[model samples]
Target: MISAKRIRIEKNQEVSANYVKKKMDFINYLDNDSLAQIFMLLPISERITMKEVCSKWQEACQLAWHDIKKYKCTNTIVRNHKKCILTQRYVEKVLFNCGIYLKELILSLICDSSIMPIIAEHCKNLKTLEFALVEFGNKNTYRFVEAFTQLEQLKVVKIHISGYNFQFRMLNSLPKDINEIHLFFKPNGSPEISFDSGIIKSTLFTTMLFNSDPVAPSFFSLKKFTNLRSLTIHRCIITDIIQEISRKTTLVYLDLEKCKTKKEIFTFNQLLNLEHLNIKDVSFMDIPNLLSGIFNACKNLKHLDAPDFHVDLAEIKMENWVNWRNLVHLNIRWQASDAIIENIIKHCNNLEFINIDELNSESTIELTKLENLNHLDFEVTNIDNEVMVAIINNCKKLKHLVLPEYNMVKASIFYDLSKLQYIESLNLAFSFKLGDSAIIAIAKNCKLLKCLNIKNCNITSSGYIALTGLKNLEELNIEMSVNVEDNFVVKLRGIKSLYCSGCHELTDTGIIQFIKNNPDLEFLNISFNTNVTMDTIIAAEEAVKNRTNDTFLAIKSVDSDIEKACHEASKNRTNDTFLSIKTNDPDLEKACSESQWLIDC
Candidate 1:
């Protein structure tokens, strides 16, 4: 009699399963075309989300989205989409409207003399200028120098020197009233840079350089820039720069990287206004002296990135960490004792960013106390389940989180990460263990994610499909995920930037359709793949060209081919239309010159 009762209970469980099956079957009773018309009445936001309901609903949502794009809607409410993008063309138009009130401008495209007049005449209040030109530079680039001097209010300028002979042009164009200057030279054999101290009229508070190599003898002295508040140099000769730089009461950000002796310790001690210090690139033999000097000088340091300390930890005293109580960002990029890390956590109570390589069990305990950490990046460190859970539970204010790659952690750890509903950026790139369940978990819970990098992960087509629900995701990196197919383009929309460099499954049709779907896409890196051909690239260029419609651009060269090309480009050219390359190939250079007007390209 008991066995008979158990069989009856088992039969009752099957009833619920069969009922769910019957309900699912009922939804497919209507054809997708009919279901799509009903779904089309919903808002675009809801229509995109409905794709994740089930296979049948996903099909209907795909069709509904297509119809919404093809057929214009009479409903004003359905058309209210808040679209925003920042591109070369977008900024050019925006400056025309708001140049007078603009306080900052960042340009990263091939700058022609075409817009220099507008900037010089209207952008009078511009204070900060980031001239991040990655294009091949030539004599025409120097023409902007005259316009730069007109912006008498410009205080900070960062110019990336790409081509030759423009360094002096930068110096002459920059106004004497500039307070901060950062010049980064590209690694393309830039000419020896020289600094004329006589031209500088105002006090330079900040000076930074990147690969400004073989600088003139006068560049190392910096005799005029005596009141530097912060100075940074990368891949340049630091021996003379450190030895000759005069120490002023205002010089605080220099001691950590340049000075390491007992005599220099007193100068650092008085620098109470120290801002940022990084010594990762410097080779240090005296670890104890370096640490002591930093401890003495870094009383008010807000940011510090220290080098590897794989030394005798017993020789160093961990008691000096209390002096770093004001540190807000600390990056210890190597293995250190648990005691030092514990001391850091205990004293650096205001730390908002922490980057460490390896964390032991003891340090993990200390990490749990940093409940307000906003950023964490552990480089290739395997975080166990307990440590991962501790972080997810404690770091409530984390907006950017990077877990360890190639770990043995369970896939369920992603579910823990998804609990961070407020997180804006999450990176799980190169994790062999991350699969469809992790993506599903993020889709179901992590609604506020704006940037997600799953590059070269173990995600499959189902995982890629699950990403359709991430409506707020603006930047996505699924590069090298071979399983990524055209279905993603059919569902995902409004992505401003996408990097699918090695996705072998993507074809021409999907890419062109994607470009059409997301009209505001600013960046796309579909390189290293053959399925996406030049035809799709031409379509992308046409879409951007139709929007920018810049029918005229000035060319200084006397070449007729360039003039003809510019005239044609005025009628058809868009950003990224021509590849700006530094090649020795004569044919390639000739081919790019006609279109780009840059001699090197």
Candidate 2:
């Protein structure tokens, strides 16, 4: 019933709507600033594309460029690429935009003369600073010396001064509140450099001697460090530092590595609060003076790690047996003298964990019979079957036991281990004498066992069947076991971490089946299993990547097949899901070494 005029008006309204939409699209395309702002909200990888939008957009980003620079929420920042002069400028630009307030800073490069000064002025609030590869001449070294005086809150500083006859005015310019300091100087001859310890609380001297000097006060002239708590001297033969530490009562942790002393016979009696002491590579085996200091003064000693100990009772007086109630972790490595073991047995009643890499029968006497022992490692060269039985019977509370290499007996060796019901982590690897019977006995007992390493052991497929009952098991290392087949992995559904590495008989089908079944598994090492193909690895990696946050799902598979899968997964890792792949490659190891927190076991 409508007229011709009304129909015409409706058609015109529809055309006008289409024209307005086209005009709005054109406006959006022209506004580069607005586009850049929108791009800023996207992820880092996506934002890289914004640079190509237009020159105007790139200029707009300059103002808010701090948002574009990378941020490391973790402890370390590892960049793969190398830096040059131009790259340094770019780095500076990014850092400037990111703001100068930093918790830690490591500048390792061949920077310009003025770079240090700029950093000192800008990074006033820096807590830890490590200058690694920078080189400076004698005159340029003093340029940034006074600049650090403003950094009043600095705690730890490690700087490598590389130059001959370098004027290190920083000694005088250093602030007094610093708790830790590590200096590396490369100077010609005996270019004297001294530090004012008025502000230092806990200091470490890591000096590489360029030349020798007789009159120098050595590395440990503590006339100023009255508040020092811990000290570590490395590579320098300045034994005078030890004498200085003898007077220090506040010292708790003392590490002296490769520091030679002229006087072999030295006694210490001063340090009362010293708990952890490590004196290594001094070459003096029969050090009675050092022993006197340790036995008498360090009453609060908790953790002791001395690798070279002579267990000779003839050398140590029998009447000097002092009780160390506070001793907890005792590690006596490579005891050349078996008599020292008796000395340890007499004292160290409160010892909980004892790691003896080399212990003879003479040393294993009354100490192994301790009821308080929870963790014990022995590399006994001269151990009888009776001595082993005594160790197992007496130390019923033992949770971790690692026998010496080439020291495995028959299956009857584990007959006494049933008494140690609390044993959790057992490493009978390289013990070829322990057959399936031993493993079966272990499964029958030691229900708390979590980590069982039978690598290079004589374990057949039947041995793995016994492990099916170990529901609490987490890690199992059965590397190089020829008898372990595909069905053996089926028994490991509860296990979170598994190492079937070098199982040449294992194929892709077995691995696929295990992955499909064990959804709780987080770490699986199929390295050296050549039968596992790339297709199967890819499928497993994809399945793991789709899992939830609490599910770790790590594949520690090496070789070309696994590496290819990992590379593909890494390229697609976008969401909160993290994929960690461990390989024999150096690059992979380096990556793993960096992310220490991600390691489960």
Tens-place lDDT per residue, model 2, 1-601, is 9989999999899899888899876735756557656766864333444555667666655543334322322211122221112235544543454425565666654345565666667666667666642344544546656556766656666666543332333444555555555555443342323222221111233333322333234322554555556566544444434456667666776665444454434554677777876666543424553554466556788776665543333444455456366787766554434455555655767778776545556456556755578886654554567777777778888888877555646568765565678988887778878888778888888889988888888888787888888877888888889988888886566677788889988888888777766766778888778787766665665555444323546666557654455455556654333345656576545444443313222
Candidate No. with top TM-score: 1
| Total backbone clashes of candidate 1, pairs 3 or more residues apart or in separate chains | 0
* Candidate 1 lDDT over residue span 500-544, tens digit each: 888889887897788667655656666666676556644554554
Candidate 1 has a TM-score of: 0.62
My TM-score estimates for the predictions, one after another, are 0.62, 0.58
RMSD over all Cα atoms, model 2: 10.5
Worst 10 residues of 1 by lDDT: 70-79
Q: What are the RMSDs of all candidates, in order?
A: 19.1, 10.5
